[model samples]
Target: MRSFVRAGYNLRKKTGKWELKVRPDKDSMLGRGLLSEKEYHDPVRVFRKAFKEYRPEQFLEFLAEAVHFSLGPFNHAPEGNLIGPYLHLVKMIDAAWLIVERASAEK
Candidate 1:
């Protein structure tokens, strides 16, 4: 219910089903919808709130290593099968390269 990709939790569709492992984020719309308007408008505050649930270390690792897929695999990926993470990496790269560039700028 936290939209497509809520950042803190990864939403996956395996056999036509959606799974949310962590909590429903009580402040989000899909959750309890109890956040103040100021919190809703502040990007930094929002990111901090989201990061509280997700691991920022993993995020940093993603930024550092995913940019180099041609280099090697990420040995520190979350414990699970590799396909999901790889697919997510491809999706993130594609979005940044294909969508953001066209939608926002010529670069």
Candidate 2:
């Protein structure tokens, strides 16, 4: 959850608190008011949707954010998305874990 928020893939927050940082754009379903509040803020749900849709780029974007943090000078804005090492560090598990149910259902 921390990693996802820090990555700002589709959400962000401060002080480890779950808050909405929605930036509705015409390109997103959220902009069309298609996603419920739970769907928009739940990291697992969001990641699952992206993964199931074969959008690996979404993961890359998350990875790029981590890379940007580690290598300060490495700008990811020009690059394209996370599915491996980084996600493991954050979750301490394999990338495949992302597609499965979270350990605890409650956030």
Candidate 3:
């Protein structure tokens, strides 16, 4: 049987705490009340939903992919909605990195 996994990443903060960060697409959906906050807030739920397990390196890969796809094809529109999602993605990346670094030190 083929098993599909929804891969996600977590970053460790200086305070010795692990913070899980989800993709902006997933985060926005959860923030907008479209997806259950439980999914984002609960690690177990996130792991189960993502289907595939992920490590720090994999999480970094995901962030890089999102950044690569976002910083291109300049928009001439007046509103910044086009790039707003990318901005949020950047923040998520930072958070994930922080979590990873913190967790590594703890181990």
Report the Cα lDDT for residue 32, model 2: 20
Which predicted model would earn the best TM-score?
Answer: 3
Best first by lDDT, ranked: 2, 3, 1
State each model's CA lDDT, in order.
0.37, 0.40, 0.39
TM-score of 1: 0.27
Please give the TM-score that candidate 2 achieves against the real structure.
Answer: 0.25
Off by over 4 Å in 2: 1-35, 38-47, 54-61, 68-70, 74-77, 81-107
Q: Model 2 over residues 28-71: C-alpha lDDT tens digits?
A: 55332333455444434444444444334545566567656777
* RMSD to truth, every model: 14.8, 12.7, 12.3
Candidate 1 residue lDDT tens string, 12-77: 211211112234345455321333444333323333444454444555454445455547765665
Off by over 4 Å in 1: 1-40, 70-107
Q: Candidate 2 or 3, higher lDDT?
A: 2
The backbone clash count of each candidate, in order, is 0, 4, 11
